[model samples]
Target chain A: EAGVTQFPSHSVIEKGQTVTLRCDPISGHDNLYWYRRVMGKEIKFLLHFVKESKQDESGMPNNRFLAERTGGTYSTLKVQPAELEDSGVYFCASSQDGRVYGYTFGSGTRLTVV
Target chain B: LAKTTQPISMDSYEGQEVNITCSHNNIATNDYITWYQQFPSQGPRFIIQGYKTKVTNEVASLFIPADRKSSTLSLPRVSLSDTAVYYCLVGGLGTGGFKTIFGAGTRLFVKA
Candidate 1:
């Protein structure tokens, strides 16, 4: 049980730059999710993927944000033209099937958009 | 989707039983109550979950009243490592979508 793993535990980029966060879920897990926590705010869901197809992405902030799960294995969240508000922690989670309970979350990627 | 309310912070001593209650009066019938623990610079981990009555695990216990208006997460004989933020989430996996919303969370500081 490796749990969920996230790449680039921390990332720093200039405003208007592009930064992509990656997540590798546990083996044989078909359900993957993305969540973000802004400064002084609660963690919010960004999107979810069941295998390679996106099951739900209604939580995405705006057009600049994009999430993809290639080959139904790993997920990537890309933020283009990042803004100052984009500085926050992005968390990835996974569960069996589409169950809401018993989800395992990644340590999260701290993105600092300067 | 049911919104949850919990304390902003709590303080307890080692070897003492800690109880943190969450209010979710509008919780739906199909929704479940789940609690998570998070350390500094770490992701949230599942502790316990219950829909009604009581549920116990090696790590913690979840108590839900008959009305299901609220739920309590009890940590027994906590240690310094238990000092972290605890989150209470209430959501149902409806076809509409998943509504797992995290609140401010209660920061439990365990002292020796």
Candidate 2:
């Protein structure tokens, strides 16, 4: 089976610009998650989606960031008016029933805000 | 979410067994310990997980004591390819949601 797929493995945008990252999870997976890791920092959870519904969005940093999973097949994270500190590697993961087992992650999208 | 603590780095050689220990003193009853391996420019890959006792897989082994306060990930006959960052996470599927928290992680350098 094909693993999780992320688009645009790398992206660079100027500050105050907008950037969007996409994630395609495995088939039949019902849960999708978004995470980001800043340089030399731990990976932080962004939000979660369960079949088109936002299950947990408490981890979202601010209002400028928005995540949506339409139809629950794939997810997209958008950072508006991106700041320099927003640069990081964003990862997407999926699991069956959002359980601890069988959670697969994509290679990640490295975002650089200049 | 339970916070985990692990060594900042470790050194080992090829054909040697490497063990990385993590501590989660405030782990809840439903919390499980999991380990992930990450290479440069890639996302993390799951290595092993265990609630208690020992769990072994094709790639590594996870050992958790009875108290469940700590756990160890053992890599047998590690090679240069095994040199990467290892993250120890403690969490579970709660009624709220699945929130995984990662620490600084241990940078394991496998030498020749």
| lDDT tens digits, residue span B13-80, model 1 | 99999999999999999888999999989999988888899999899999999999999999999999
CA shift of A38, model 2, Å: 1.2
At residue A1, what lDDT does model 2 achieve?
Answer: 93
Candidate 1 residue runs with Cα over 4 Å from true position: B93-96
True-contact fraction per candidate equals 0.67, 0.65
TM-score of each: 0.97, 0.97
> In model 1, what are the clashing residue pairs, if there are any?
none
Deviation of model 1 at A42, angstroms = 0.5
lDDT per prediction? 0.92, 0.92
Cα miss at A8, model 2 (Å)?
Answer: 0.9
Quote the RMSD, in angstroms, for model 2.
1.1
Query: Chain B TM-score in candidate 1, rounded to 2 decimals?
Result: 0.95
Q: In model 2, state the lDDT of residue A95.
A: 84
DockQ of candidate 2 compared with the true complex = 0.66
